[model samples]
Target: MASLSLWLFSGLVLLVGLERVAELIVSNRHASWAFSRGAVERGQGHYPVMVVLHSALLVGAVAEAWLTDRPFLPALGWTMLVIALGSQALRWWCILTLGNQWNTRVIVVPGLPLVRRGPYRFLPHPNYVAVVAEGLALPLVHTAWVTATVFTLANALLLTQRIRVENDALRELAVMS
Candidate 1:
């Protein structure tokens, strides 16, 4: 049962990784669109770090689950799975709402109006909310508590800096407009 659960969890991680690839494809296209509109990218320094940490998150969850022989508690696992799925939904909502304005990098086109639809209607950084939820829920889906803990802490710090850069860029855009 434990091995089967591990295999299942591994498959889940792979699917999520594939989803990330799809996101990157979309993000690249959107980035090109933004650049054509004279987008100014800020916070380049943290982009690679963000990529590494997110990749590590998937790897860590699977490694920890396999290494520690973590058993799937149906109660916790199912609940976490739902939350993780919900987070994905929220992330896609953000992407679709932002449309061509969205990129994995903080590339904001000057003179473009701010987005306030979908999840953004409620929160200044709704995508980060999805990120936080996924960081916690994905690992917990297979009881990778250590991965969940470390990722949550690291992501919180990353987001603190990330949000500041984003807000600064937005403020600049507002001032320009």
Candidate 2:
């Protein structure tokens, strides 16, 4: 049952990984389009590093799940899945809200006001909220609480810098607007 659970959660991780890849691809394309058309101020730093870190969460989660042989608890997995699914929805809502303004990279257009609509209207960092939720839920899906704890802590540390960079870029754009 534990190995079966490992396989199942690994599959779920793969599905989410594919979705993340698709998101990255689309974001790259859209960001390129926006940049070419003079829609953003490009703040190119360690974007690829962020991508790598994000992918590593899945790798870590899967490893922890399989190696630990975490027991199968339907309630835990189902609850985590629910949170994970909700975060995905909120993430897309963020993408839609930002429109062409959004990118995995920190590219803020000069003279354009920071998007204050959709998810942003309520939270200064809705996408980060989604990310934080995801960082927690994905590991919990497989009952890999260690992964959940470690990844969440690591992500929080990374986001500290990331969010500052994003905010600085957006603040510049907001001033111009």
Best by TM-score: 1
After TM-score superposition, what is the CA distance of residue 9 in candidate 1 from its true location, in Å?
0.6
RMSD (CA, Å), candidate 2 to true, equals 1.9
Backbone clashes in model 1: 0
Candidate number with greatest lDDT: 1
lDDT of 2 by residue, 1-177 (tens): 457778888899999999998888878887787778666544456666677779888998999888877876899999999999999999999998988777788876666767778988899889999999999998999888988898888888778888888888777665533
Task: Give the poorly placed runs of model 1, Cα more than 4 Å off.
Answer: 174-177
**In candidate 1, what are the lDDT values of residues 21-134, reduced to their tens digit?**
999999999999988988899999999999999999999999999999988999999999999999999999999999998888999998887888798879989999999999
lDDT of 1 at 85: 96
The lDDT for every candidate, in the order shown, is 0.93, 0.84
lDDT assessment of candidate 2: 0.84
